[model samples]
Target: MASELPMEEIVRRGARTNFEGLRESSFVPLFLTLWGRQASDDHVRQQLKRHYESVTDHLVGVYADFFESQGWDPRPPFTIRDFAVTLTALVEGLTVRWAVDPDAVPLEMRSVQSSMRVERQDDLDAGPWDLFGIVVLALIPSMTVPRIKRDSELWADHEDVRGLVRRLRETWESMVGLSPPAEAPDHTAPESADHCGAEPRRT
Candidate 1:
């Protein structure tokens, strides 16, 4: 994130920088003000509501495909945290690929809304499939998974992105000995049946 400058052009690269430095940047205030207003506005609130509902529906469809592929029944929808994490992972993955392949749509998308002109975002907003925004905004949800995973030690469970498959597999094998409650033997079931018929004659 740091850029080099010749000795003559001294930029203050330090711990406590000046407030004035941010003002020099073109899009900072523009994007913040715009996003601040839009995010809090009633219109934006309605839009966000609709978006969450639609994405929840989308989660259902995605899980349907998932279960179908595995020959398992579709379970209930994800918890909010799970849904958000899954969405972030998908989006961040898109951003990673977008960074490599600079297709016009992807290239125009910036990390923050203020990085570009509002008109530009609006223009790209309606463009074919919103390919840029779809992948760009999609990133918000997909990004935080690995961080939380690392903190919680759940990183070892995933093999797809981090390439920790071998480690994860070893850990899984190590922990696979215990049967779950549902699969564990229920001693009372058969014992109850045996005692039931015999004791019922006395009743």
Candidate 2:
């Protein structure tokens, strides 16, 4: 059912789901701490590795579908698999920070006006959600623009690329002016099962 949604919708839903789970459980943090200290333990390391691999594989498939639906080719130099791995790494790094200090890390989804508070680096009270927005904005253009340019079908002329760049710039500017939201959006809403193609079964 989830596989039928647009890429943006899927990502939003997944993030909401993850935030809810993390809020309800301390297990993820405890496991990460233990894994960091017990890196030499083959059994524990293998379990963690397997989990990451599974997530990466799932993301790759999702991204491949997304790119295809956008009229973009999922080929080398900017492959869906590589993008998934990078995205997974980004999320894991953010999770580590959240685990260390949940309050300081903003993972919710409310109006930016409610949570734009900032503090010094030493104070460690910076708005992480704002940081996330900046990082994502920077990453999307750097990653996708080149790929879109490489494919003639995706980019008909200079105007097309320029239009994308202009939109990106506008979004970045707007994001810079806002802060992270305080509450997460509802993730319990039902999604359609209208698969664009054969949906892969998740493990």
Candidate 3:
């Protein structure tokens, strides 16, 4: 099903859908509480652990498909598994923080405001799900870098991911009627730099 959509669209849709589920569902918190309290119960712990693993596995499969659709290989030094685990951890951790204190992080409020502006709506009308989606979007890029950098060769071919992120940010800016930021200078080394010396010279 994810194959039908562009990677960017798939990411946006997935983020929004999952964000909504997390925000509106009490079952998530209930389950987390149960896991925390029942950690010493082997049966309960095993069940919860399996459930979490299954969910992360499914996310890895989706990411694998997305990478394949873009002609990118989802394998070591960092694989879809790595991406999935990291992404899920970020989402879960942030959701807990937001649940505890919506304004615990100033970025959370800023993301909500940015999303509202993009939607051309007031905060009251935006709803918690919309704010959650905004937070996910804001967090995805930074989380992606570690996986991308793990294999420089693979990353070179998949550099489009960076551009895609930039475009997404620009889209939000345009929606909110703001000027896009100036492009930063490229500081990346040339392919041949690897052969030049042990360390590439700075430009």
Q: Number of the top candidate by lDDT?
A: 3
Q: In candidate 2, list every pair of residues with a backbone clash.
A: 109-183
- Cα lDDT of model 2 by residue, 1-203, tens digit: 22444443344454545545554676667767768866678888887788878988887787666666655553334566777777666655666787678776676434552444332335333333333443443455435533356554333333444565555566676779854356886667655574436586688
lDDT by residue (tens digit), candidate 3, 1-203: 43544444455567667755776778778878877867688888888779889998899888776665655564334566777876777667667877788675333344344444333344223333344455555544433443335443423334456554565667788899999777986668464647666675689
Ten residues in sequence with the least summed lDDT for candidate 2: 119-128
User: How much is 26 displaced in model 1, in angstroms?
Assistant: 23
Consecutive 10-residue window with the lowest summed lDDT within model 1: 7-16
Superposition TM-score, candidate 2 onto the true structure? 0.48
lDDT for residue 135 in candidate 1, whole number 0-100: 42
Once superposed on the true structure, which residue ranges of model 1 sit more than 4 Å away at CA? 1-36, 72-85, 92-203
With candidate 2 superimposed using the best TM-score fit, by how many Å does residue 193's alpha carbon deviate from the native?
Answer: 73
- What lDDT does the true structure give each of the candidates? 0.39, 0.56, 0.60
In terms of lDDT, model 1 sits at 0.39
CA-RMSD of model 1:
19.9
Off by over 4 Å in 2: 1-14, 22-27, 74-76, 108-134, 145-203
| Candidate number that wins on lDDT, 1 or 2 | 2
